[model samples]
Target: MSIDTAPEPGRTHDVRSADTDPDAGAVAFRPAFRAALDATAAAGVRVHEPGTEAYRRLSGTFNITKAVRPLAVVEPTTPDEVATVLRLAAVHGVQVAVAGTGHGATEQMDDAVLVHTCAFDELVVHPHERWARIGAGVRWDAVLEACAPHGLAGLCGSSTDVGVVGFLTGGGVGPVVRSAGLSSDSVRAFDVVTGDGVVRRASATENPELFWGLRGGKGSLGIVTAVEIDLLPIAQVLGGAIWFDGADLPAVLRTWSQWSSLLPDEGTTSVAIMRLPDMSGVPPVLAGRTTLCVRFAWTGDPEVGEEMIRAIRCVAAPLVDLVGPLPYRQLGAVHADPSDPMPVHEASTLLAAFDLDAADELVALAGDASGTPLVMVEVRQLGGALRTGPDCAFAHRDAAYQLFSIGIMVPEVAQGVVAATSRVHDGLRPWSRAGGLPNFCDQAGAERVRRAYPRGVEDRLARAARRYDPAGVLLAGRGLRTAADAVG
Candidate 1:
């Protein structure tokens, strides 16, 4: 059973000698690690060394801006194997980071042991129970396709490709958020392995504290193996975007903001100013041009939705109108996010109010006339069901709008993106709230962690982290370590 002697049935390779370097502080605990690795390998785990091709492929993320160089990347096929990885990391004094689709890449891993959950692709839908059990690696698109035939829908974010577990753990906000609330609010249970190497089922009736912390705490608490979430009885929705020329930015933005404030709970909307590149997949009219896109999603009657959206339609002459009734699976068209992988830097804030002055400020900074380097600046309306969700770790319930900006991470424009994002934040400071959505805070610092949660929730999360992960082996949100230390 020695780690170096033989490879188990599903185990890929033996532990290389280079991985046992004595000078390496945490990963170099040789004697105890051999036993831990042997046990994990015997249980069908594959441990890939730093320079190996498997390690390189597993260490990469969807956010190309972050270059993760972990000490080792472990691929665990079953929940037992996941527990073994955590136990091995704890015993060897090495940190562990979970990568599920790698969309939300933060600077939370440094010389840590990364667990790639891509192989845990399990998806089962219970039409009678109106719930679905999805693996940590399953994407929203897969869930959507599985539930489509049953006239059900998962509360997936704008991009259907985003990982379900990561999105739900971070309090996912999607196109139907105003109607269905956060994606986390629908979770019935989660099968997770804490830093202590214990597999526990968390739910409202089970480990309530762990459930609350995991709902909005992201990966700071544990690595989720599978999640059971409630699905909605929604088959179709009247949703899409109406594009207008940049010349009408001011009028369209102000009109949409004012109109959105009067919208009902069934109608959700957002406005974005995009500077799309001239790529092949991009429409010729929108490519390389500053455009104003007004996105809307209505769960009500299609006729009523059309009547309600007519006010914005007549605000200014639109360049294109693609809004109409469509199946719920086509929700991605509402935002039209880039599907290709590219390096990007993003910054976001929740707004207390968005008035004419806020619109003017946005136009002066990121509008067509501003000559900004940022690609897209979006303002999404918030409230309704989103404000009435059950008390969880998610904060900013009373915020009126969410403002976020994204820019390419090219070497020539990296500094420019940072400066422009800071300027945008400063310009909208008057309307900005204290906290932001957990999913949108892309940086890895204590201040960003504090902003993701409210005043009291952070303390509770810190205590939970100490109780569940005393050794701090889970490095997904190491910034929260500062909060835990302050409370102690």
Candidate 2:
């Protein structure tokens, strides 16, 4: 494929593999990639060289992985250039890891080609048509901010800083998911670079197989450059968090589980058990306390929304009732996921339903009186539009709820935290869905992914992978049944 008119004007021959020396590796491919990146630098693409100021900024902003270090970071300006980088990586036998906003980054990639798509950021609104064309590098913040002027919004996940591509690819379930469906469901098209180093467009009518795989494939298929999605007419949200003391956590959690079941599709909510350390960002009252937080988001009319949220709020008097009319940009405060990166070991299992019996059991596992938790134990309500799969290929949309546990691996208690989380998951097995969410898993690999996608869907996705990645060199924990099944 021909390169886009990048300022760096990279028209060099492929680099051959050299010795393991860092200097050798840098001399081998760094200059070529830099040239390509330089060509696009004038086009809003920023190239970060090793040991440079720009490189440090890029690395620090996405320090999601603790061990792995990228050789160099390349921010490509256009889809063609992204495809070129993939082709170059494949030719050089170098692994390529795509980084969006780094919200779901799991591993570090030493000596790998890191493509930071942030330079591709763009959010174009079509209010009258109720649709949007966004760059893959774009974040929920861009969509939320741009759509506000026209009274329109997209289905974005909890943290607005999360990249649109990464979130949507992992099956986005958000506050308004009940009404607008998943972020993937709103997808109209995606411009992506496949493992074969080709840039292709995926839509319902064109490349339908890939369209299905890419939606929930979780970066297993290719690197997306741009996407088009449907937008909703939403100016504001009746959503935020209501915090209760740790002592009232059990009863509050139980009541939330039971009460949320009766909620209509217009309502979305979740319960979190947070043991926040006393820090500058944390509220004084909530700092150093293990608190129970019930978060609510209602997309219906304001009057009915208040009534819907009131049902759960009445379960117990909250120490801090902060739920009310809020702008869409403030949606991150609802979940309050720490913006900083710390070592987090997360596991998730879905429940068939959260009946009263299940609720009691859930509260017992993570309640304040239960024991010291490794980290936060969150129960997010599922169903509603989540029960309905998007028009793409992602599977497992029928789960009732997702039980997510985040255990910080403190030096002395790492194993205990893992054990406690495992015990909790095992205890909830009877009420849990047989599988898990692709996004929530950490190192479970393809066996875990099989549970995420049903059998028929898995077969179809494998075929598409075979078509695009016949050699299996592009494998990065993809849609296959097993890691060994990658090349098939």
Counted clashes in each candidate structure: 0, 5
Instruction: Provide the overall lDDT of each model, using Cα atoms, as 2-decimal numbers.
Output: 0.85, 0.73
- lDDT (tens digit, per residue) of candidate 1 on 1-488: 21222223543333334444322233334555545555566667887655556766777777788778766677888888888888877877778889888788786565577888998899999998999999998999999999999999999999998899999999999999998898899999999998788899999999999999999999888999999999999999999999999989999998887899899999989999999889898889988989999999999888999999999999998888999987998888888777667798888989999998999999999999998899999999999899978778888888999999999989998999989989998999999889889899887767768789876899899889888888888986577778889988
Which pairs in model 2 have colliding backbones? 6-39, 7-39, 8-38, 8-39, 212-393
User: Candidate 2, residues 1-488: lDDT per residue as tens digits?
Assistant: 22222122233323423343232235336665445444434345444555455454555533333433566677778887776666666655566677776666655566565678878878788889999989988888888888888888888888787888888888788877776677798899988888777889999988888898888877777888889999887878898999999888877877787788888888888888888878898889998878988988888888998988777778778889999998776777788777776776678888888787877786677777777555688888888877775555566677888888878778787888889889888878889877666666555346656767777666777777777765543545343635336435
Question: What's the lDDT for residue 325 in model 2?
Answer: 95
C-alpha RMSD of candidate 2: 5.1
- Shift of residue 36 alpha carbon in model 2, Å: 13
- Candidate 1 regions with alpha-carbon error over 4 angstroms: 1-43
Cand. 1 TM to true fold: 0.92
Please report, as a residue range, the 10-residue window in candidate 2 with the lowest summed lDDT.
1-10
Which regions of candidate 2 deviate over 4 angstroms?
1-56, 59-67, 444-448, 477-488
